[model samples]
Target: MRSVYMQSLAYVDANRIYSRIMELGEIGRTKQSGVQRLALSKEDKEAQILVTKWMEEAGLTVSHDHFGNLIGRKEGEKPHLPIVMIGSHIDSVRNGGKFDGIIGVLGGIEIAQFIYSNNISHAHTLEVIAFCEEEGSQFNDGLFGSRGMVGKATEEDFQKKNDQQVTRFDALKNFGSEIDPARYKESVRKEEEIKIYLEMHIEQGPYLDVNSHPVGIVNGIAGLSWYTIMIEGTPGHAGTVPMNLRNDPMIGAAKVIQEINEICSSQPDQQTVGTVGIIQAFPGGSNIIPNAVQFSLDLRDINLTRKNRIFAEIEERLQAICQENGLSYTIKTNIELDPVACSEEIIDVFTSIGKKLDMDIPIMVSGAGHDAMLMSEITDIGMIFVRCKKGISHQPEESATKEDIAMGTEIMLQAVLQYI
Candidate 1:
């Protein structure tokens, strides 16, 4: 293999990679320019088809797993060697930006194209992947595909329903990627030789954009906990129920969410943040007092001890509110994700690659979750970040410059060259 020009790699048909990103983003574009390709949605399946076609055109063997993850393998000099994987989720949140997860997977594809043209061959296999269902937009099941890969998903998970329109099993079946019952008990990492897992994504925050950096190396990811709360109360006519007499769950819920924010806010420098994303009452009409209210709370922090402390404070606050309001409440933690630290070895390699290419790069932590977090539990993981215009994500305004994408791809190309 010839030596990479490093900086010149950014100019190698850079427009082509950007064009491909735009093309793929258009497949699931909603009315607001936000992407709508929720996991296993028809849009997601279509995007898979399109990328698979491109992978085949790139002369890579492509296939889908039981979890619907699209894997495109570019065989290296040694077919049996451990694989070097680079990718991110293909599914997007509702009204999400085009470049968030797409950049990573598409960037991997672009890297494969660059390697092919350069005739670079490694002793190990290289795979460009598009992980399915990372967002949990369609069904509140985050990192479904990666969870399956790590053998975390159970048989009961298949029975979970999404708004009565889709079941996990049904969605997989629709995509022709259904998992057998027996496979549920099988291991995801059949081979213990995975060298490293790499992901390239937009910073999804203002750090890189504000700092004027084109590329970033991720050091860690924040811990996350999602919980659902339900408060039950007696129903009554709005006008007839006195404020003190009424067991209004809505009032209690409002107080709880407010207190949750206040508690987490008391932490140092806002290390903890909580959001009650969804809230609704049983008697949603204006004429009646709400008998019950259901809501969800998402809490996140970089430290696990602080995360737990915040959660405890939230629970205590909610219990007090319900007690004072004379209402019954139930809480269930839907998911708990521990903070993940990237491998120092992988981080050094990425940093060295950036310096070798004279790219301005800095170390950072991800505020959002990615499949990389899960992959870290199984093997050494590394991440590259391209800057978004305003550090905005999960919205239509999210934007990344072509130069940033090209630079990230160049860094990844160098890393892959050394890693594989």
Candidate 2:
């Protein structure tokens, strides 16, 4: 079938989009003005229900899978053609800002509403999805909904437990999802059915704001490796133990963290980063020497080879530090994701549209992972980023101006029109 040419242009209602964003924020609103709609929780379910309602109001047919991924589809002029999927997740990290995942879903809905109201028919069907559990804040399973949609999820994933000691199976039950394994397979869409996937999100970093760019075109998503390290040592009285003689595991942990920072910084490419986000020293007391220390290591880089090499060096240096400190250590790797590159064709489309619209659109790599990375496994994917204040995200202070969001939505609308 031949692709549909652009017949007319449509505009997005920025006020409506912003209003929906604020409405979704209220479901899991935090005292700090952030959101805490963890996946499969009551807040998340409410957010999903509200979004589904909006999707229906937009004149789209809504459906959900066993994994609870909500999909709203608007038929195209050529129903047999593949679909153009546009959306992001609704779930948020603990105390996450309002725009992280909310914009993509709502932005897609606004675009759909525009098209429906204008009676502009495209060549392929348009689908907006509010994915479940993209933050992994609740179950430690990032991209849970996207993975299931792409056939990358397993039964074991459903059986995983959360902090409250509740399994995903039970959580889904509580959220009122139908848990039939046989029918769950229907949730996975065939790759051939989807022509392209588009997502819009906040820059979540300082790049766009510092450079004074209103929108960012993502070229790639960085790969990530997560490791938990535990050090064992003898606990003793802090006052009685000599500094040189004390076998404190905290010392070993400190040394490892310092070396990791140094190693990552030493790399020629400054894109590689290593962070020790979580740390715990057991037998905690001012007078007691800590006997055990546990810390989490997060490594990210667009280059997989360099990322792995850096991880290897960190492990080696950590082992040496433990040996010298007379401490035994164990390392456990929890998650590893390879980098995903965006579609060059889609990038070119966005660039061409930006130039035509007289906008400054710079292409950049994503430091944080998103559902777009998972969607890349099945179809060509592209991402548009709106500048956030100080590049702050995953917190209450995260924000983007109405003008920036409107500019982003305009670009996205034009790009979809041109591509479809």
User: Clash pairs of candidate 2?
Assistant: 205-391
- 50, model 1: CA deviation in Å? 0.8
Candidate 1 structure quality by residue, lDDT tens digits, 17-109:
789889988988989988888888888888888888878766678977777778899887877778899989778888788887888888888
TM-score of 1: 0.95
Q: lDDT tens string, model 2, 222-283? A: 99877889999999998898999989999899999999999999988689999997899897
> In terms of lDDT, which candidate is strongest?
2
* Model 1 misplaced regions, further than 4 Å: 1-12, 177-187
CA-lDDT, candidates in order: 0.82, 0.87
- TM-scores, each model vs. reference: 0.95, 0.92
